[model samples]
Target: MTVLDVTVPFSTQIREASQAQHTEAENSTFMSDLLSGRLGVSAFRRYTEQLWFVYRALEGVTDTLAGDPVAAPFLRPELFRTSALERDLDHLHEGADWRSALRPLPATETYAARVLEVANGWPGGYVAHHYTRYLGDLSGGQVIRGIAEKTWGFAHKGDGVRFYVFDGIANPAAFKREYRALLDAVPVDGPERLRIVDECRRAFALNTALFADLAEATR
Candidate 1:
C-alpha cells in the first residue's frame, strides 16, 4: 500500500488561492481607516459587537462536530474568542453589559449564517470557515489589537483589546505552524479541496462586505 504524501500543504494552497480576497479586505477603506488610526473607539465597538455574533455562530457548532476528523482538528479551544469579545465590549461600552449590544448588521448575520450552515453538516466546509476566521484572528488580528490599544490608550494593553489577545497560546508563530500542518494533513482532496478553497475566498469576500458596511455606517 502506498501511503499518500501531500507534498504541498493545503494551507498554502488556500492562502495563494484566496490572496486577492485577502488583499481586498486588508486594503479596504474600512480596514485602512481603522489601522491608520482614523476610526474612533465607537467604530471599534461596533466592530466588536458585530464580531460577537459571528464568533458565537462559529463556536456554537464546535461541540456537535467533535467526531469529525476534518472539522475536529480545527476546533481548537484556544481559538474561542466569545468571552474575550464580551470583555472588550464591556470595556468599550464602559461597564454596560454586552448583551444589549448584540446587534448584527445584515452582512454580519449573513456571514454568521453561512458559518452555521457548513458547521452543521459539511465537515470539510466547516474547516473552510474555521480556517478563515481563526487563522486570520491569530495573524492580522494582532495588528488591530495594537491599534485599539494605542488609539484608546488602553491601560496595560487592557480589557478594551482582549479579543486579540490569545493568552492560551504563548507563541503564535509556532502555533500557526502547527495549525498549517493540521491543514496539510486533513484527509480531503480533489474537488472537495477546491471547494474548500472557494469557500475560503467567499469567507474573505463576506469579510470585505462587512468592512464596507462598517465604513458606510460610520461615515
Candidate 2:
C-alpha cells in the first residue's frame, strides 16, 4: 500500500478520538457561560480575536506550502477554512468594534509563543500532522453547532457560530483524501517520519493543555 493509505487511517483515528472526547452539551454550557456570564464576553472576544491573528499569520505559511510541488498535491481544500474562520471571528461582535472589545491576556501571548516555537521546528509533513491532531479541537464544529443552536439561536441567528459551518461542508471524506495525499508526499526517512509523528502527538497535547488553561482562567 502507499503512504496515503497508511496516513489516512492515522488521521482518521485522531479525528475519531477527538469526536469521542468532545461533549457538545458541556461545551455549549461553557461557551454560553463565557459569552453571557460574569466571566466576561471580553475574555472570549479577546481570545477569539487572538485566534484570528494567529490564523492570519499562518495563512502565508499554509499558502506557501500549498503551492510547493511536494506539498500541493496533499493540501486539503478544507485548509482554506482557517482564513474563513478568522474572518468570521473578527466579525463576531458586529456593530460594536472588535478592537475596542479586545482585552489583552497574558495567556494569549503564552499560547501563541508556544505554538510559534513548535511551528518553527516543523518538518515537511508537519502541516498534515498539525491538521490531523488539532483541527477537531480548535474547530469544534459539532460542539459549536450545539452551542449556537441552543444558546445564541434566538439572539444572533446563525452569525454567532459562523466559525462552525465549514462553509456548509456536509462531507469530510474527500478532504481527508487530499490531506492524506499531502502527508504521503513528504520525503522523509524512517526516523524523521517517526519524529514528525511524535511531534504531531506533542502538538495535540499542547493544544489540550492550552484549552485546560483557558478553562481554568474562566473559573
Candidate 3:
C-alpha cells in the first residue's frame, strides 16, 4: 500500500473529532454563535488574522529547516501563501475593535502550542515523508477544507474561512503523484521507514490531543 493509504485513516479520525468539537462549541459559546452569525465579515476577519500569524511563523520555521537538504524539500512553503488573505487579516487586526474583544480562551493557545511542540519532535525523514509524500497532495488541504466548511462555512462567510480555500485548485491527483515521487526518492531502509511512519502517527496523535485539550479547556 502507498504511504497515503496508511496515513489517511488517522487523518480522517482527526477531522471527524475536530468537526464534532466545533459542533459542540456552536451550541455552547455565545461568541462562537455570534461570529458564525456575522459570517463573511467579522468571523472571517478574525480567523484570517490568526491564520496569518500562524502561516508567518511556519514560513520562518520552514526556511530554517530548508538549509538541510534532507528536510528542505519537505518544507512546503508554497502551501502557506498569504498575499490574497493578508489584506483581510490586516484590516481586522488594525480596524476591528472586536479583534481584542474575543480572546481564544486559554485552551486554544495551549493546545496549539502543544501541537507545535509535538511536530518539532518528528525526524527530518518523517517530515519529508509526510509533507512531500502525503500532505503536499491535496489530502492535507482537503482536511483543512472539511474543517473550514464544517466550522466556519456553514455558520459564517467566505472571509472567515479563507484559509481553507487552496486557491481554487480542485485537482489533487497530480499533486498526489508528485508527493509519492518525493517519498520514493528518499533513500531509507525498512527500519528507517518504520521510524518515519511512527513519527507521522505521533504527529497525528499530538494533533488529536491538542483538539481534545482545547475542547476540555473551553468546557
TM-scores for every candidate against the unseen true structure: 0.94, 0.63, 0.53
lDDT of each: 0.87, 0.49, 0.45
Candidate 3 residue spans exceeding 4 A from truth:
1-57, 81-137, 140-157, 168-170
Candidate 1 per-residue C-alpha lDDT over 69-167 given as tens digits, one digit per residue, 9 for 90 to 100: 889987889989999988888888878766864678889989999989988878888888888898999999989988787788886557988888899
lDDT for residue 126 in candidate 1, whole number 0-100: 82
Off by over 4 Å in 1: 1-7
lDDT of 3: 0.45
Q: List, residue by residue over 107-211, the lDDT tens digit for candidate 3.
A: 445434533553455444335224422352255434434555675443232444455455544455665556456555555544555555555544444334433
Order by lDDT, highest first: 1, 2, 3
> Best candidate, lDDT-wise?
1
Off by over 4 Å in 2: 1-47, 67-71, 74-78, 100-107, 114-121, 133-140, 154-157, 168-170
Task: Identify the leading candidate in terms of TM-score.
Answer: 1
Candidate 2 global lDDT:
0.49
Q: State residue 114's C-alpha deviation in candidate 3, in Å.
A: 7.3
**RMSD of candidates 1 onward, in order:** 3.4, 5.7, 7.5
TM-score ranking from best candidate downward? 1, 2, 3
Q: Which candidate model has the greater TM-score, 1 or 3?
A: 1
